[model samples]
Target: MRQFFVFARKEFYHIFRDRRTLLILFGMPIVQVIIFGFAITNEIKNADIAVLDQSKDHYSARLIQKLTAGSYFRIDRNLQTPKTIEAAFREGRIKMAVVIPPRFGQDFFHLRKAQVQLLADAGDPNTATTLVNYARAIIGNYQQELNGPAALPLTINTTVRMQYNPALKSVFLFVPGVMTLILLLVSAMMTSITIAREKELGTMEILLVSPLPPHLIVMGKVVPYIVLSFINALVILAMGVWIFGMPVKGSVVLLLAECVLFVLTSLGLGILISTVTDKQQTAMMASMMGLLMPTVLLSGFIFPVESMPKPLQWLSNIMPAKWFIIILKDIMLKGSGLREVWPQTLLLTGMTIFFIVLSIRKFKIRLS
Candidate 1:
């Protein structure tokens, strides 16, 4: 007991006293969360819009007035000819163009059907989709008031209530993804490198020859990191909740338990990598290239899974972080409980067991 405490204390001292470790442990998570929350997002606001109102009537003018009144778009340039719409799009000055055909108000009052053409830049599909939706909603609201709601008998009433993010901000998604990445990098990659360093320094042989059992030594090395990573997870969750107002719909205890399981899975992965590679440099590189890269790209952390190439979609099924991110989002955003996220929780648990067994086998091979 005393020896385990002493070794654990030594591990903490090594972590706290080292400047680089401290920076990675604390600084990387904050910077990653900030970059992800603010820098990387799908929300498009104040997009430049150009108007080509040939109608020049009350109806056309009012529609333009409504578009500009909303914060989603800004009318940057007014055009006299149809050619300017293409020019505005080419110049990238405008993402949307509203062209009101001749006699728009006359047609609306008499025929009760006026066409308002909406031309959008589909170069960025996500932004384009959002912009189009916003434009349609604004125009539809105005049309309802003008034509009377009852007359448009073919009504498509949408009762959409955004559960986790009412504003549909992208940061709510980024927070959990960033937290998963940071936890993986710090816990798995860092632990692997640290273990490999002992091998490179020839200290591992000495430890193996000592009275401490191999599993005990490995546990001693890993316990402090688990504690450190738990704190890191807590910090990110707090930031997501307090700063971004991201909802925690599920039990906080369940969320933390899932986080701990994920951390253990990552640590197991690190240990497995460390056992495979005799050199610290190789282990670090493998962790970065093999685990970190794929975890970010294939996990649907930044990119939507539905939009990914078919093969990559199939490949994402194997990525552990994908399951983690889904579970976190379910718990944090949807307020989902164990019943809702059990499949993902089970997947993570199965992966953790697999990694631990693989690492053990590899460790035995290395010892032999």
Candidate 2:
């Protein structure tokens, strides 16, 4: 019994001494609670919207004011022309667009039925539906307000036009996210674990002593993952297109190139993980904590980033999967070209370069 107590005391000291273990036990829960508490939300807030109030009348202005008055919507752009609606959606500027046709107040007062078109970017079906529903509820409430003062109740007919995805298919939205997740986990996690395994088995030391240059050593370790992850991406894309009828509207060549770039970025991230950890378990844990959680929560996979608080939104900018998912959606759903997606492409490229350079530096330190 005394021996058992001493062993337990020694184990507790050992756990306290290892910062990584202490972090897994304490730091992860706090971070997860904070992230999940704030991030895992279905209710949309502060979603940017555009209003093209051609009516420009008293009622139309009042309705516009009503829409933006609450926390649900903010007017980012008051579009001058109807032609720019598609451009705005393509650029990912706004979630929904409100078009009140000419003579909206007159129609409401005289005809009792005024038409308001709600144009929603249904690329994310859930958000699109939620936005439209919120808009309709507001419109309904406004109708009631007018009816309260009138002898007869007025009607506001809302015409919902779901852009990008008229059918509001759920599969369209999940494909890009799943592809990003698979590539990230397979490329980054596998590369880190494989390299860490080499270190654990003492083969990495042998390679470090060999004639192979340090950069090549890292490249050679990650090259197989790039190929495998690319293949994995292609398979997921094929399943999305053929099995689920997901549309690929943009240039296939450009999409393939972007996939390759993302895979390389993920591989670089994995190599960075391997450089810091000698054990496979540590490498896996680091990859999951550092990469996976951020990718899911902050990358706009399941939750909308715009709906999150300001700080989480800012932190989301650092996620590679976020940029890649945007690229995927831009190409696949929006049919966006290099001109539209160049910024995200450049961001991913920069991240890849940064990861590789940092990994090489860390590897050199290990070599010493």
Candidate 3:
């Protein structure tokens, strides 16, 4: 036990003594978090739109009011004719144009059917679709108010409040994922490289032959990295909180516990990779291609997991990062407690245990 403490102390020395490693472990996470938090987002705001209200009546005016009220669309121009609307769209002053026919209010009052045309620039299909939905919803609300309930016996008004991210900001999701990626890269990828480097330098044999037990030797090599990565995690969390105003609504202790679990899981993977690959290059490549690629692409970091095909989605279930990201979002954004996120926490814990067991078994086999 005393020997273990001494080795752990040595690990801290190595981590602090190397400036580059220290910075990568600490600086990179904060930078990546800030960059991803601010730069990458899917929510659209203040997209320019044009209105062509030939009626200039109460209905057209109210419709314009609703459009402007929602922060998604902005009135860039008020065109008089169809020619002007077309010209505005052609000139790129507006990506969408709404044309309301003459006597729109009168038609609604008498016939309960007023025609409103939504002309959207389909050059960008996604933006066009969102604009159409926004316009339709706003107009639909007005139509309901205009026409007194003639109606169906039952109405289901399912108002969905996207709780954690009411604005549907992608950054809210990306911040945690990017943090997980950087943690895995630093802790798992770098540790694998370091361990394999020792083997290539023939120093691994020297360490093995030392009075230190094999497990202790491995621990000494990894402990420094663990401390370094922990510091990086803290730096990233600080940047996320300060720079992005990302709230950590859960207990800080719970957040740190989850992060440490994720780091240990990654480190176990690194140890496992080092045991499998003889060369430093092979270890690095395996870490990059085998682990990093899947974690980033398949972990629902950039894409919705539900939208993925059945097989890929099932594969994602085994990814440590996927569970980590879910736990992170629940704790940081939704203020979820241990009770709420226990399932994800348990999943991550199980992965960590599985990875550690596999690595230990592989290491024992290699020793034999």
Candidate 4:
């Protein structure tokens, strides 16, 4: 027991004494959370738009006012002809152009319907789509205001209730992803690099030949990282809740427990990586290629897995971060319980066991 404690203490000291390790262990999470929270967002704001209001009527002007009143858009140019609308988009001056035909107010008053064309740049499809949607929603709202009590006879009212995230804030979506990313990188990449570094420095052989058991030595090295990873998880959660208005809908204890599970899984993966590689640079490149890319791209973090092809979707199922992110969203947003997340939990447990066992076997072979 005393040897174990001493080994763990030594590992902690080694980590703290290294400036680069200290920076990654503490600094990376803070920067990632802040960047994801504030910068990387789906919400469109202050988007430049051009208007081709041939009507120049009160109704058209009011609709334009309503569109520009919110943070979504700003009218950068007023187009006189249809030719200029394309020119505005081509010049990179605007993302969308709203064209209201002449007699728009008269048509709305007499014919009860009017035509408005929304021309989007389509250079960036997602942004263009979002801009068009925002414009349509504003126009729809204006129409509703104009047609008060005597609702249009055949108009079907489809009330969309956005559950969990009513504001549609991208922060809610990003928080879980950022948490998964940070934990995976810190626990897996850093641990692998640290272990590989020891091997490279010939310190691992000295530790192995000591009185301490091999498993104990490995455990001691990993324990400090576990503690650090957990602290990072708490920091991210705190920032999500207090700074970004992210809700903890379920039990905080359950959330933390799940985070610990993910940390252990990542640590096991790191151990496996270290067992395979003899150099820190090799381990780092492996970790970045093996873990970071998949976590960012295929884990349903930035893109939807359902939208992916069948083979890619199957590939994503193996990504541990995918399951962790799902568990996070379920618990943090949906207020789900153990029963709801048991399948994902089981998968994570299986992965952790597989990684740990593989790493042990590989380490024994290397020792032999």
Model 4: residues with Cα > 4 Å off, grouped in runs: 364-368
lDDT of 2: 0.82
Model 3: lDDT to the true structure = 0.82
Q: Which predicted model would earn the best lDDT?
A: 4
lDDT of 1 by residue, 1-368 (tens): 67777877888998888999889888888888877778877777899999999999887889899989967899899999998789889999899898999999999889878898989999988788889899999998998878774665586767988756787788887888888988998888778876688788877776677666666666777888899999999998898888877888889999999999999999888888987887889998998889878988999898888899899999999888999999999988788899999999999999988987777666642443
**Tens-digit lDDT track for model 3 on 1-368?**
78777877866776678897667667766667767787877677798998888999877898889888978899898887788876787898788998889998899878867899999999999889988998898888877776667676787777787877776767677788888998988788877876677777776665666687666666666777776677778888888778777789889999999999898889888988887777889998998889878998899898889999999999999999999999999999988899999999898889878876777666532322
- Compared to the true structure, candidate 4 yields what TM-score? 0.95
TM-score per candidate, chains pooled: 0.89, 0.60, 0.80, 0.95
Top TM-score prediction, candidate number: 4
Q: Across residues 261-358, which tens digit of lDDT does each residue of candidate 4 receive?
A: 99999999998898889899999899978888889999999999999999999999999999999999999999999999999999999999898878
User: How high is the CA lDDT of each candidate model?
Assistant: 0.86, 0.82, 0.82, 0.90
lDDT of 3 at 173: 77
Runs in model 2 lying further than 4 Å from the true structure = 1-155, 365-368
Report RMSD for candidate 1. Answer: 2.7
Error of 4 at 149 (Å): 2.6
Question: What is the model-wide C-alpha lDDT for candidate 4?
Answer: 0.90
Which residue segments of model 3 deviate by more than 4 Å? Answer: 1-10, 56-62, 76-94, 122-124, 141-172, 278-282, 333-340, 360-368
